[model samples]
Target: MLYIIQTTLTLGFVYSLVALALFISYRILDIADLTTDGCYVLGMAVSVTAAYYGHPIFGIFLAIIAGMAAGYCTAFLQTRMGVPSILAGIVTNTGLYTINLMVMGWSSNVALLKKETIFMLFKHLGIGGPWMDLAIVAVIVIGCMALLRYFLSTRLGLSIRATGDNKDMVAASSINPRFTITVGLVIANALTGLCGALVGQLQKSADINAGTGIVVIGLACLIIGETVMNGKKNMTRNILACLIGNIIYRFIYAIILQTRLIPIDFLKLVTALIVALAIASPSLKENFSLYARRRKESL
Candidate 1:
């Protein structure tokens, strides 16, 4: 049970970065960038490849740079080539598969053979003792959350936010909506890359198909986060929501799986159901509140 709890917390922190990425792209930018899955794999491929070469620490930086490059490609196709946002992401993602394979030496997966991961390095420092993994990932997640909040408060970040809210108004205000969109996607995918890098190092392996359905899962986490928290009007609350939602989701899934409430084969079905309920939660809450008010009026 302790092991399960630790695993749940570690993964919740690792996966929340994806939710954070979606918070920027889907929520702030209003762009459905489908490049998420491929970019995730690209990050993993880059990180593991670097780690295999005995540069575990440098690998993370490379993964983030690779993710930024992927984002630039998608942005180029969308802004410069006049491609639709969704199609641009699809084209970039399809191309990333080949790039990922090349990075993995044309292999489907790569594993670290007794490499010194950041987790091990930190553990050697005798900090957090038995909870080293949890400690490292938790710190990274908190750092990212804080950085994202600060970034969103900056001038350029405001431009990106405005671009999402009203591209026309932003353009009229002398802000290049295209530029803001490009920067926004770049940052969002960078977070995705960081998440991928951390997960790869933690697991000591990377797979070509590891990012499959990641966008859906991220979306589920994002929607779930928004539903779980009230007054998400502030940047801080919304940012925290990503962490809170993933933790809650991980807890629910782990408990159900551990207790045999759901078969392993039906895990995907359960995820879909959770996502649906989360999507409808706001409406349900509103209706319930309305009903309560009407009942009081009648009384």
Candidate 2:
């Protein structure tokens, strides 16, 4: 049970980065950037290739750069080439498959058994076991949360938020909506790439299919966070909500797995169901209340 809890926490922290990325794109920028799936694999591909060359830190940097490039392509398609945002993301995502394969030397997977990774560095420094994993992930998550909170308070960040709230208003206020959207996506995808690189290092392997359904997962986490932390006005609180929501989601999954009632093959279905319920909850509640009131009136 303790092991399960620890594992859940570790995965929660790792995936919180993805949730943060979604928060930026979906919640802040009001853009459903479907490039998440492709950018994730791109990050793993770049980081794994770098790690294979004995520079794991450099691998992370390369992953961020690759992600930003992917974001730039997506943004260019949307803003400059007159492509619809969703279509642009789909196009970039489709193209990234070939790019990811090329980065992996035309391979579909890369393994890092016995390789020295960032985590291993901690182990070598007398920090071993699951505690080290938890500590490392905690530090990264907290640091990211702080940095994001700070960034979102900046003048440019306010412009990005305003763009999401009202694009026409922002444009009329002398802020370029196009530039804000581009910057928001670049930063969002960079965080996602960082998450992917860390996940690769954590698992000691990078697989082409690892990024499948990531956008759904990230969106689900984001919705769950908003649902749980409803009406919170503070940016820090909202960021914390994202992290906590991820941990809670993982814990729920862990509990379900322990029951042995569902097959591993149906896990994705379960995730979809959870997301559906979260998305529908508010409407469901309203309808239920209305029905109850109508029944009482009829009585």
| Among all candidates shown, the one with the greatest lDDT | 1
Model 2: per-residue lDDT, tens digit, 1-299? 78888889998998998899988888888899999999999998899888988888899889999999999899999988999999999999999999999998999999997887777787876756668888887898889889999999999989998999887798688898779999999988998898899899888888999999898888787777877887247777678878888888888778778886778679899888888897788899999999999999999
Kindly report which residue stretches of model 2 are placed more than 4 angstroms away from their true locations once superposed.
284-299
True-vs-predicted CA distance for residue 96, candidate 1, Å: 1.0
Cα lDDT, all candidates: 0.89, 0.87
Model 1 lDDT on a 0 to 1 scale: 0.89
lDDT of 2: 0.87
lDDT for each residue of candidate 1 in 175-220, tens digit (9 for 90 to 100): 8977998999998899899889999988999999999878878888
- The weakest ten consecutive residues by lDDT in model 2 span 229-238
